[model samples]
Target: MPEEVKAHITGVVFQVLAKPGDTVGAGDAILVLESMKMEIPVEAPRAGTVSAIKAKEGETVQEGDTVALLE
Candidate 1:
């Protein structure tokens, strides 16, 4: 099954740490969001291969937006 990694808050995507086809463990940081002068990391919900990155660096994302896909 595929899992979606979502943003927890509205913010600008600061960095993308994983690319498609990358293997990731549970809780591994996939990206970071900059909001209110703080950096928030978006982590994998489970161990899997990173299938896609929906958000890009410097892009603005809303709360609950899917940032990446894992499978």
Candidate 2:
């Protein structure tokens, strides 16, 4: 099954740390968000290979928006 990494808060994407085909562990940071002058990391929900990134740097994302897909 595939797992999704979602944004926890509304923010602008600060950085993307994982790319498609990258192997990631549970809790690994897939991307970072900039909100309220703080950097927040969006972590992978499970161990899997990164299948896609839905958010890009400088893009605004809402809470609960899917940021990446893992499989």
Candidate 3:
């Protein structure tokens, strides 16, 4: 099954941390978001392998937007 990793806040992607084929644990940050001069992490909801990254660096993402896929 595939799981969607979502952004918790509206922000521009500051950096991408996990790439496709990378393994991550629950709460692992897949990317960083910059909003209001602060950097926030978009984390994996559960332990899984990264299948895809939908957001790129400097991309603007809204809250609840899918940032990555986990399988």
Candidate 4:
């Protein structure tokens, strides 16, 4: 099954650390979000290959929004 990597806080996408076909471990940072002067990572929920990233660099994302898909 596929899993979602969601933003924990509303913020602008600071960076994208992984791309489609990238293999990642559990808790690996998939992307970073800049909120309130802090950089937060949106991480993979489990070990998987990155399927897609919906949020791009500098894009604003809301809390609980799906930023990436993992399979």
- CA lDDT of each prediction against the hidden true structure: 0.95, 0.94, 0.95, 0.94
Give me the runs in candidate 4 sitting further than 4 Å from their true place: none
Q: Extract clashing residue pairs from model 2.
A: none
Candidate 1 — which residues are off by over 4 angstroms?
A: none
TM per candidate comes to 0.96, 0.95, 0.96, 0.96
Q: Root-mean-square deviation of each candidate, in angstroms?
A: 0.7, 0.7, 0.7, 0.7
Candidate 3 stretches with Cα past 4 Å from truth are none
lDDT of 4 by residue, 1-71 (tens): 78888899999999999999999999999999999999999888899999999999999999999999999
Off by over 4 Å in 2: none
lDDT score, candidate 1: 0.95
Q: For residues 6-64, write the lDDT of model 1, one tens digit per residue.
A: 99999999999999999999999999999989999999988999999999899999999
Q: Could you tell me how far off, in angstroms, the CA of residue 19 lies in candidate 3 after the best superposition? A: 0.5
- Give residue 60's error in model 3 in angstroms: 0.5
The worst-scoring run of ten residues by lDDT in candidate 4 lies at 1-10
